[model samples]
Target: MEFSWLETRWARPFYLAFVFCLALGLLQTIKLYLRRQRLLRDLRAFPTPPTHWFLGHQKFIQDDNMEKLEEIIEKYPRAFPFWIGPFQAFFYIYDPDYAKTFLSRTDPKSQYLQKFLPPLIGKGLLALDGPKWFQHRCLLTPGFHFNILKAYIEVMAHSVKTMLDKWEKICSTQDTSLEVYEHINLMSLDIIMKCAFSKETNCQTNSTHDPYVKAIFELSKIIFHRLYSFLYHSDIIFKLSPQGYRFQKLSRVLNQYTDAIIQERKKSLQAGVKQNNTQKRKYQDFLDIVLSAKDENGSSFSDTDVHSEVSMFLLGGHDSLAASISWILYCLALNPEHQERCREEVRGILGDGCSITWDQLDEMSYTTMCIKETCRLIPAVPSIFRDLSKPLTFPDGCTLPAGITVVLSIWGLHHNPAVWKNPKVFDPLRFSQENSDQRHPYAYLPFSAGSRNCIGQQFAMVQLKVTIALILLHFRVTPDPTRPPTFSSHFILKPKNGMYLQLKKLSEC
Candidate 1:
C-alpha cells in the first residue's frame, strides 16, 4: 500500500526534476568547454579581414620604424577591423560627422572616457565620474587660466632662445643639421617640468642627471612603447607561463619616481608657501594650484592622487605638443606656399619677432586654422575609446550587444571625402568660417568633442603657437632631399625616424 502511494505521488515528479537538472548541467558543461576552446583557438577562429595572426593588425597601428600606417590610413578610406587580444573592434568611421557624435556621446554621470583611461589617468580629472570629476575640474580651473598662463611666457621665450642657441652651435658644424623632433621634445619637456614641478627641478639644464624627471621619460617607454622594449614576445605559450621579473622591475622604477615628487610637493604645501616675496608670486606653476586645490569639506588631494594627475598632464600636455609641432613643421616643409602664408600672417602681426605674447597668439586666427588642419590629419592622441554603458542603438540602426568597447576610427574619419571636400589635400582653407560653419558638427574632432575633450587644449595651442612662431622667425625649414621622411604610429603619433630637415636662417622682414 505504501509503495503504491509513493509511486503515484512522488516518483514521477522526482524523476522529472532529476531529468531537468541533468539537462541543465549538461548544457552548462558544453558551454564551458566551447568557451575554453574559443579562448585557446581565439586567434584562428575569429573572422578578421586578412591579417597575419601573430602580428594581427598591431603592426599597422603599432608599427615599428615605418611610415606605412600613416600612408595606409590616407590611402585606404573605408571600414577596417583589428584584433586586440580576444576582442575584435571595428574601425569603420570615414565620415567626419559620425566620428564627432560617437566620441561626444556621454552618460548622465560624467564624460565617457573611463575605459582606456583607467590604465593611465585613474581617478584624476580625466577618468573620474560625476561629482568627483566636476569637483576636480573646478579646483583645477585656476591653474590653466589666462592670467596664470601669462606668468609662464618668459620661460617659453627663454626655452626658445636656449633651443635656438643650441641649434646654432650644431648647424655651424659641417653637415651637422640636427633632428628637429628631439629639439622640440626637449623644449616641450623642459617647459612642462618648470611649470608642473617648480619645486627643485632643473630639467631645463640637467634632465639626464635628475632621476625623477629621467624616470618620467622612462614611464612613457614602459607604457605604449615599441615592441623592441619588450623582453619577451606575447603568445599562447607565454600567457600560461609564470609572471616575469621584468614587469616588476619597470613598475618599481616608475612608482618610486612618482612617489618621491608627490611627497615633496605635499611637504611644501603643508609648509604653506602659497604666496611669495613682495606679496605676489611671479608664476603659477601646476603645484601651486594643485596644492591649493581643496575638495568638498575642506579636503585636499593625497600624494598618490597628485602623482597620477601630474603624470597625465606631463605626457598629454607636453609630449603631445612636441609631437604636434614636429608634424606641423613637417607639413609646412612639404607645403611651402602654406608656410609662406603662415609667415606672412605672422609678419603682419608681430613683424618677424622670435616670439609672440599669449594675446598676440589669440589674434592669429589663420595660424590657428593651419594648426587645426595639421592636427586633423595627424592627431597626437590617435585613438578614442568608449565602452558601451547599456545596450543601445546607433543612428545606423544597429543594436550593439552590451559590454562591447567602441573604438572611434579617428584616422579613417579624418580622410573621409564625403564630409570633407578634397580630403587628401592639405588645405587650411577648408577650416574657413564659411566651410566649417556649414559642415556637420562632427566633421572635425582634432581636440575630440563633448565632455572629455582635452582639458589642456587652449594651453597646448599657446605652447604650439609660441614654439612654431619661434622656429619660423629664425629658420626657413625645407624637407631634406637625401631621404624620404616618414612618421611612426604609437599611442602618440611620432616620426618614424628623427625629423631630418634643412633649416636655413631667415632674413628679417
Candidate 2:
C-alpha cells in the first residue's frame, strides 16, 4: 500500500506536466493558422504564382530564376504577392510609380534583415531605424562632403593604377582571357582601405594571403547562404551548425582587425598626433571623421557604435562597387563601338595624363552614360527591402497593412516593359540628359532612392569614373566568345561563371 501511494503521486505530476505542454503547443499552432489565413485574405488582391503548401514560393525564387521571374513580371504587371513559407509573405513591387510611393515613406527596414545582419555588421546605420538612424546619419554626413570626396580621387586613382600595372604584366606574358571580378574586388578593397582608414594594405597584390580580406569574403558568403536557408534561421539550430561555426571564426578575425585600427586611431588622437600633423594630410578619412564627430547636444558614438559603423562601411564600400565596375567593363566588351566612344571621350579629357581630376569626371559625359546604362541592366544591388510601419496605400489605391514586408525590385523596375522602351538593349543614349529628364524620378535607382539612399554615392561615382578611365587608357577590352556569363543575384548581382574578357594593351600616344 505504501509503494502504490508513492508511485501514484509521482505519476500524477508527470501526467499533468505532459497535458500542459500539449495544450500550449496546440494553442500556438492554432494562433499561427489564424495569422496565415489573415495574411492570405489581405494579400488576395495581388496576383501570385502557384505555391506549395509547405515550400511556398521558395523553389521559384532561387538566384538563377531570373528568366522565371521576368515571365512572372510580364504576366502580373506592377505588383505581386511572394510567399516565402507557409506563413510569411511579402509584396514584390516593380512599377516605377509604385516604387516611388513605397520608397518615399518612412517605413523601417525589414525585420528579416535585422535578424541576419546584426550578427555580422551589428546595429549600424544600415540596420538602425527611427531616431537612432537619424542621429547616425547626421553624424556621418560630413565624411562624404565634396571636399573630402575630392581628396579621395587621388587615393582611388592610385589603387586603380596598381591593378592596371599588374594586369599589364599578365597580359604581356600571356594571351589568355582574364577573370576580372576577383581582381576588381581586391582593387576596390584596396581603395576602401586607403580612402576610409588611411591604411595602405597592398591587398590587391597579397589578397591570397591576407587574413582580413579572406575573412570578409568568407563571412559575406556565409551570411548570404544563411539568409536563404530557412532551417538556419533559428538561433539554437544555427549555433550548432558548420556554417555558424565558420561564421564565428571569420567574425573574430574581422573584429580583431577593426578593433586594432580603432585602438591605434584612439591612441593617436589622445596624443594630438592627427591634429598636429595637418600639413602631412590633405583631408581626413572616414575613421578620423567618425571618431571626431559630435551631435547637436555634444554626444558622440560609443565604442560599440564606432565598431559597427566602421565594419558596415568597410563591407558596403567595396563589394557593390566592385560588381558595378566589373559589369561596366563586360558591357563595354560586348559593345565595342560604345567602348571606343567611351575611350575617346576619356582620352580627350585626360590627354596622356594618368592622373584623373574631379573636373575631368564631369567631361566624360558619354562614359558616365555608359556606366548608368550598365547599372540599369545589371544593378549592383538588385533589391531593397522594407517593412511597413503603418498601412501603406499605393498610387493605384491598393493598401498593405502595417506588418507587411515589401521588396522593392530594382532589377524588375529597371526591366519593366512599361517603364523602359527596349529594356534589354544596352543603349547608352537612353540616359542622355533629354531622355533622363522625361523619366520618373524614382527610375534608375542603382544606388537606391529616397531620404535613406546610399551615403557614399559621390565617392562611388568618382571611383568608378577614375578606375574605368584608367583601365580604358591602358587596355582595349573585348568579350571572350567561348565563355559567356550567367547572371546571379544574392547580396549583389554577379556573373555566375565569373566575368572574363580579353585585354589587348593600348599603344602609347
Candidate 3:
C-alpha cells in the first residue's frame, strides 16, 4: 500500500501512539484482573448480589428507566446483595422490622441521603434528619390538620371537575380513544400548583404549554436520564471526569428555577397583609405556610430553604398523586367492574353534584381503598435511599458498614407475595379496615414509615380523594381502545401511551 504525503511524516508517530495505547490497554486489563479479587473481598465483608468482576451486580439493576425495579426486586428477594462496583447494597429488605430501622432517625444507625439531592432539600422537613426533622414536622403538623385540609377540599374538587370537563371534551372528539395519561399528568400538576402554590398551572387548559409545567416536566425527564446514567458511572468518577460539568450545569438550572419561585413568594408575603382579619393569619396556599413557618426561636427560613421545601412539595406532592391516580385509572380500565363499583360508591356518598368535605371524604371508604390499592400496585417513589453513618447490625444478624448505599426497594415490599395475598391482582378491598390489619405494620408502606416518611402523605391523599371522587361522580371512565396505555417510569411513573378513556357524561344518564 502506498502511503499519502500526509501519512509519511505523521504515520510513524501515529503507529507509535497506537502501539502505546495497545500496551496501556493490556496493563489496565491486568490491573482489572487484580481489582476483581479486591471486589470479591469487599462483597464478602458485606452481603452483595452475585456480581461481576468489572461491574459488580450493576447489570441486575441496569437499564431500568421504565420503573421496573419492583419486578427486579421481587426476583432477588434478599437472597444475595446487589453489587454495584465497590458498593454492596441490598435490593430488598425482607424483614419489616429491619426496613423500619432503615427509615427512622431514632434507630441510632446514623443515616444520610445528602449525596444526590441539593442543599435546598437538605434542611427541609421532608428530607431533614434528627432534631431538625422532628421540630419541623411538629411545627408543620397543625398546618395540615384535618380542618385545615378540609379548606383545600373545595379547591381540589373544582380542579378535578375542571379536569373532567376537559377530559370529556378529549374523549368526545377523538373516537373515544386518547392517551389520557398526559392529561392525567397535567391535571395532577394543576392540582398541586393550586393546592401547594395557589397558582394554576393551566396545563389542562393549555395542554402543557405553560413554562413552569413544561420546564419541570422536561427537567424531570432529563434528571431521570442522568440518574440512570449515573448508576453505571460512579459519582466520584463523574466529578473527576468531564460528565461532572453536566451534573453541575443541570443542578444550577434546577436551583435557579426553585430560587426564583421562592423569591417571588417572599416578595408577595412581605408586601401583603401581615395578619388578615379572617380566621387564622394563614396564607391561602403552601407559599403562605412556607413563608410564615418559623424555627424554634421564631426566625424565618432563608429564601433557599423555603424554596427547597417548596420544590420538594411541588415535586413530591405533584408527581406522587399523579402516578397513583393514573395507575388507579389504568387498573380500573383493565378491570371495568371495579371502576363501576368505585363510581357507585362515590355516587352513594355525593348524590346529585354535592360538594365534598372532610367529613364526607372520611365516609368514602371505597374511594380510599381504591387509592390504597393503586399505591400498593405501583408506588410513586418505588425506592428509598439511606446510608449508614457507622456499622450497624440488624436484628436478623446482618451488618452493613458505614458509607454503604442502601436501596430500600419499595416495589419489592409492596409486591412481596409473603406480605400480601394475591399481590399481583388489583384488589382494593384488601385495604378495608379489617383486611388491612392483617398485613405487617410496615409491609404496606407506600408513603414509607418512621420519621423521614413523607409529610405530604395526608395532603396527597386528600387531594387525590377529591380528584378521584369528582371525576367518578361526573364521568364514567372506560379504557380508550385505540391507544390503550401502558406505564413508562420517569420521575413520576407515567403512562407509556396516554391514558385515553371514554367519559360517559353521567348527568345525561
Candidate 4:
C-alpha cells in the first residue's frame, strides 16, 4: 500500500529515526519508574490517607478547608503523603521533631511554591538557595541590626500615626466601624516604602495612590489563584491563560516600580560620590545597603540583583507585617479583657498617647505577650515548603530521599495538642517568661525556626509592638458582633471577610 514511499532509499532512515525516538522515550519512562519505586518503598513506612490512582490526594487539596486539612494532619500525627500527580509527592510534616529535623537542614525551597513568586520578587533572598542565599543573608544582616532599626523608628511611627489619624477622622465622622486589615496593609506598605527605598509613599494621606501598591496586592491574589488552579502550574499553559495575562501585567507594574527605585538610588549614590560626600548618613535603608553590599569577589550587586532584593524587602516587610498586626488587633478586639490589659501596660509605659521610644517599647511586656500569642494562633506565613536537597531522617527511623518535597506546617506545629495544653485558647500567658521557658523552642515558630528563620523578625516585632501601643494609647478596640471576620488560609492566613472592629475613644470606653 505504501510501495511508492518505501521504494525511496530515505524511507529506511526515517523509519529508523522514528523507532529511535520511541525507544528513547521508553528508556526515560523506565528510569523515572525505577526512581519512584525506590522512593515509594521508603515513603510507604510513613502513614498516608487514601489516594486515587490518577488524582492522588489532589481532590483532598481542592476540597480543602482548614478543619479537613487539620483532620488529615491529626490522623497522620507525624507526616503524610500528598501526591501532586503520578510523578510528584510531598511528605507533609506537622510534628515538631520531624519539622525541626527537616528545617535544620538548608534545603532549597520547593520550586512548585516558589515558582509562583519569582515573577514578582525575581531570584531574591526568599527564592534563592545555596551560596547565593548565604551571601545575600550575610550582607543584609547588618542592615536590620538593632542600631539601624532604632534609626528608623520615627519613619515607622510616622506611618502608624498616619493610619491612626485616618482612623480618628473616620471615627469622628459617620463611620465608627471600619475594616482594620486594609488600613493596616496600607500602613505597612507605606512603612516598607520609606524603610526600604527611603521614599515617601504617603499612602495614608494621599487621595491618589501608587500603582505599584495596588498591583502588588493584586499580584499576590493572582499568584495564589494560579497556585490552586493546578492547570496553571505549567508555565506554557499558564502564560496563555487569562490569569497569566493579569499576573504578567501586574508583575510588570511591580518590576517597573522596583526598577525606578533602584535607578533613582543609584543616581543618588553616584551624585554623592561625584560631590565627594562620603560621610555616612545616620541611617541606611534597605536600598542603600543593597547598593553598597559587595560579594566575596568584591563585586557590587547588579541592578537586577538589587531589584530582586528590594522586591523581596518590600513584599516580606509589607504583607507579613500587615497580616501579623491585623491579626493581633483582631485577637485583641475579640478579647476585650486582654485589650484592656495591653492598654494598661502601654499606658504605664508611655503615659497618654506619647511616642513609643525604643526603650519604652521593651517595657510593654504584657503587650508583647499578646503579640506572641497572636502569632502563635495565626502565623503570617502559615507553612513553609522546601525541596529536599539531601536525604532527611526523622526520629521515627523513616527516611525521605532527596528530591522529595517537604511542607513544614507552621500552623500545625503551633496547634499540636502535644505541645500546648489548649491549642485554641486565646491566652497571652502562654508566652509569659515562665511559661515560655517550659515549652520546646521549636514548639512556637511564628517567625519559623532554625537556619532559615525570618531575617526580619525583630523588625516585624518592633512594628507590631509600636502599632499596638499607639492604638491602645488612644482608643479602645472591640469586636464587631454583627460582622465577625472568618478565618481562611491562603499564602497567608487571612480573614475571608475584612476584619471589622469597633473603636471608641479611650475616655469614653
The model with the greatest lDDT is: 2
- Candidates 1 and 2 compared: the better one by lDDT is 2
Query: What tens digits encode model 2's per-residue C-alpha lDDT throughout 1-509?
Result: 99999999999989999999999999988997998999989898887988888767666656568778788888888989887778778789999889889988889998888887765678899998889999999999999998999999988988888888888888886665999888898899899988888887888886645787668667766776666666677788998998889888888898999899889888888898886653466778999989889998999999999999998888788878988999999999999999999999988899885578899999999999999999999998888889999999998899898999899999889888788888889999999999999999887898888889999888888889998998998899998889888876677777766799999988442
Residue 103 CA error for candidate 2 (Å)? 1.4
RMSD of each: 8.8, 2.0, 5.7, 3.5
Better of 3 and 4 by TM-score: 4
Tens-place lDDT digits, model 4, residues 177-224: 888888888898899888887787677677335587678667877777
Q: Which candidate would rank higher by TM-score, 1 or 3?
A: 3
Stretches of model 3 off by over 4 angstroms after superposition: 1-62, 65-76, 85-91, 104-113, 119-123, 173-175, 228-256, 274-283, 480-486
Instruction: Give TM per candidate.
Output: 0.79, 0.95, 0.81, 0.89
Which ranges of candidate 1 are over 4 A from the true structure? Answer: 1-48, 51-56, 64-80, 85-94, 107-122, 173-176, 199-222, 225-247, 277-281, 352-355, 507-509
Q: Write the per-residue lDDT of candidate 3 for residues 215-283, one digit (tens) a residue.
A: 555555544544445342456765765546655665666677667766766666577743551134233
Error of 2 at 59 (Å): 2.3
Indicate the residue-level lDDT of 270 in model 2: 88
lDDT of each: 0.64, 0.86, 0.66, 0.80
Please, what are the lDDT tens digits per residue for candidate 1 over residues 1-509? Answer: 99999888988898999999999999977885675344335323223355554444665545453344434545544334454322333334445544654665563322223322333444677666567767777778778888878877767767776777667666654444457877777778778876776643445455534443344444344344422222233434333434324334544665666567667766765677545521344777887677668966898777656766776776677777888998898889888998888888887777758556777887777777888899887887666665556654555554444444556656556766555666667899888889888878876777777877777887888888877777777677888878555665556677757788887766432
